[model samples]
Target: MEFFNSGLRKNITSVHPAYFIIGGFIGIHNVKYYYIFLSLIYILSVLGNTVVMTVIIVDHSLRTPKYIAVFNLAFVDLFGSSALVPKVLDTFLFDHRYISYNNCLSFLFFCFISLAMQSLNLVALSYDRLMAIIYPLHYHVKVTHRFMLFFISFLWLFVITVTLFAVGFLTRLSFCKSVVINSYFCDHGPLYRLACNDVTPNYAIFVFATGLILWTPLVFILASYCRMCYALLKISTSKERLKAFKTCTAHLSLVAIYYLPIIFVYCFGASIHPNTRILSLSLTHVIPPMLNPIIYVLQTQEIKESVKKMLKFRGRTKIATKN
Candidate 1:
């Protein structure tokens, strides 16, 4: 009878420790306002990324190779934000943070995959810009649809393999103590803290994986952009040079926003305080998606013109329907 009663109590009291951990970070003091902020961030991110992606897709004139890369980035950001934001909002707002073991694993898996894809896509974008600026004559012929498709496929495959290895290492350990993850999301670093077993292997794998994915690509991007900058300086016409600079500015800004926080968070390791982690994760998830649409619309004059045309068309259609 005691054994049966204990089992019943266990079943009744069982809560995913992730709930408490995330709640602690988000609901640090005021639970109500924290959730409200989280909701606002989620809604804004979804709307902004969605609008950017839709505008790119619907505008036939915007279907260039360059815009295709932008489309891929937008798509990844949309889903990437979705992977964590919704669940996070739900957890904070409603106190419904009951994710099963399987669901938690799945969430972690998708988040890692989406993030890897985003990084890889940025690298591709950098390279595309590099080719356009350095070898304008051969840009079209060299970066064909087939080449883009192949490169994207390779990027996804490489990230997937890395994710599988990381996941394998993570899942091997048992979480017998506090299962709570002390971040806004199920990041490997925070999750590892809850494990009962030795995590040296996990740390080693994480370092190697992150270095390969983040550092190597970052080096390539910086090198390419440096070369592009040198080339831009040589152009004689101020107007053409300004236009070229403007073209690359949005991409560079987006890359900086997306990557700088990530590098800071991971490279700095556990030296950062828990509160710092919460703030960093929130900014990383919230700011980029909200700003990406603004960056694209402001940078690309063609997109601005299209937006004006769209608004005018809508106004005319509304008047015609009323008449």
Candidate 2:
């Protein structure tokens, strides 16, 4: 409460026309190492997501609702990272920290949309898994391609609409004397914490919007997994249970990694060190996206089989040329 009140007091200062993003470093001996490390992460996240999306598009066998969801997740991860990481790199490495008011709001809008969209995609993936496990015989029938398309469309619409509402109000809030953001990106909390005006309305809408966008999907995922556990219990054969668990392992890992930092950043962030907070925030943005394809898609049997077949075909072509 003291921290929150302190933050509030900090907000009640003179307004700045623009803002500077103070890229919080991890106490590295050389800041270049940090920049290089983040640059590697950004590159890998983009490449990984691109590979996943390309595989989904090119591999006709993977043209299903499941892969479609994977594609969407990859896209969101790519979009989200692209939105934040470049700006972060510029701020830290190139000293382009000063962001105009419009640009700051733009960054806030896209980043929020990315976060919300990814959360919703994970929720959709959970439903996909649940339907597969619980309605195995009717999974395709129950979750058609059209249904998935509609669901994804609605998710974008809902998140964008809510994000626009939140960011629109955020842009109206008056920022004070300190134009420097402590975190790497234009996070809503830090931005609003800089506001000089009464933030009660914005804060209320932010909480409600956050709950709607982030927590709602998380609740759905937990509930789905709980039911999945019950369904697994009903399966008489250990083999079937094992198979179900194996299928879910990746999703569960992703869900855990993605949400834990989010919970920390939102709830217990004040208790954490500033450097650790910055690292956690960066990790939340980078780690899951970088790992999603490796864990969820590339490790799957279908992709392995496709790659094997492609390699075999290439080998045959080489043999034919030699002959």
Candidate 3:
């Protein structure tokens, strides 16, 4: 009777595993080449984002609400990639597969938080742009550093709270089943699905998070662009229209690079191969961080001028040192 009672208690209690094996890159042929590509991408992402952040920091002229949003985007990109890439290489490339329960939760928390912030950071930028274009007369008065700071701080608070709740909910689940996570990292969906207990709440969290973090931002950005388009059409001359449109080019490029692949994955994820999907998603995470700074440098006139000024000053410094 004691043995049967023990079994019943064991069945009722949560069986949290000590470690989860990261098998995201398993059963794939010659994936080392892909790992090498990730290594290169990570390196570029770090360098590019660092430069953009540095430029924004040092150039007093770039000190505006718009640049603040740009700075946050760069930081978020660096952060998101830093959270994901190194761990991926450690697990898949170096074969450190077993992640402890606490560490796995921490990992998932960081990743989701960064992703949420990335999407919302774009919304912040769109707000800045909307004010500049739609309300040009009051742009200066309306879009202040104080306002952006408050808005971003609010975003940080909300995203952290929701993500913590999501991660916290994982502790409630009983994972008596397989501990091998099939995704590239400690993904929310795959990790929660492995639970032996009912996972309807986790599924609810997934839906809520996806809609809030992904779709909401995209829809808001689309609306902002539509409004900008309508405002631009009122401009009488083609030259004026072109100049206004130029302002949004870099931002639009960034939105495309960051969001399009995600849109594709969402639309066609079921039809795609798992390995292909993983690669595509990974690219979306790493590639945008690399390209974002490049777009700013190339497309934004202010950033371009700032770079030129800095390079000229460096050249003068070199000449002075030689003398």
Candidate 4:
């Protein structure tokens, strides 16, 4: 009720801009080169994630609860890259920085939802690993096929609802002070802080998003690994412990590639130059999606084997065709 009344008040009073100028790359020279590199990254991300998903789908062997999480992770990376990259190329490379208010909101929603789901899916993968290692006997009961679907469904709903709320609050803000957004995409912080009216709700959601999506997922993963390590210590055989830990290498590598730059950027963002901050943050978002599938394919024996089987099958079919 208060939200509606506040919306009505803001609608009558707020000076909504027709278009907002994206000034994230305003002063940087030769920045088109970076965007050009990002274009190549996007292509690789698309190809890698597509191959991962295709392998998971085509091979019935990967139909377990664990691969479901892996499939979802690959899908999220692909979806997130698709949502962000082309627009980013157009916005910076072609100098099309004037984004309409509604389009900006839509862009914010998709990008934020993808960002949220990316971390949540990692949380899902971490849970799968934790169950397999820590609760080996109950791994089936704890993370069944049905349970994984339910868990992913619930997380999707929760993430989408929260992202919508965050975007909704921006509608009530009057942005008369400025229409220049200082981030690569329509970042919540720079956009909402530009508003002239009450921004408490918007600011609150921004902080909440940072914690909920960024820090919280990393914490959950780290805690899960700690528990696994503790459990591994109880195993008397060094070989067994190493073998058990080996299963976690892919997930750990994913966490590192995804979270390290992000942590670095947010932790040291202020002291750094704005351009440097943008570059750091941009890479944080872009690099992980490209690397996730590569990490899994190279580090995980299962995926590698599946890929080999598919290639062998394809080669046999080709030979048969020749025959």
Please tell me which model should have the higher TM-score, number 1 or number 2: 2
lDDT of 3 by residue, 49-73 (tens): 8988988998999999999999999
Q: Taking the tens digit of each residue's C-alpha lDDT, what string does model 1 give over 39-112?
A: 77778778877877878777898877777777877887788788877887776677665565667777788888
Residue 257's lDDT within candidate 4 is 89
lDDT of 2 by residue, 1-323 (tens): 23323444443435546444554663546868877887898898998888778777878999999878889999999998899888888887887766766788888899889989989999888999999999999999999999899899999999999999998887677765456666787777777886778888988998999899889889999999999999999999999899987888878888988999889887888898888788888888887888887786555887667667767888999999999
TM-score for each candidate, following the candidate numbering: 0.87, 0.89, 0.94, 0.94
Evaluate model 3: give its TM-score: 0.94
Q: How close is candidate 1 to the true structure, as a TM-score?
A: 0.87
Off by over 4 Å in 3: 1-14
Q: Across residues 1-323, which tens digit of lDDT does each residue of candidate 4 receive?
A: 23322333433335677777777876789887898899999999999999999999998988999999899989999999999999999998888987888999999999999889988898999999999988889889999999999999988998999899999889998876667788999988898988998899888878997798778988999999999999999999999999999999999999888888877887899999998998888898889999999999999999999999999999999999999
Top model number, lDDT: 4
Misplaced by over 4 Å in model 1 are: 1-23, 237-239, 266-272
Q: What's the distance in Å from true for residue 17, model 1?
A: 10
- Ranking by lDDT, best first? 4, 3, 2, 1
In candidate 4, which residue pairs clash? none
How many steric overlaps does candidate 1 have?
1
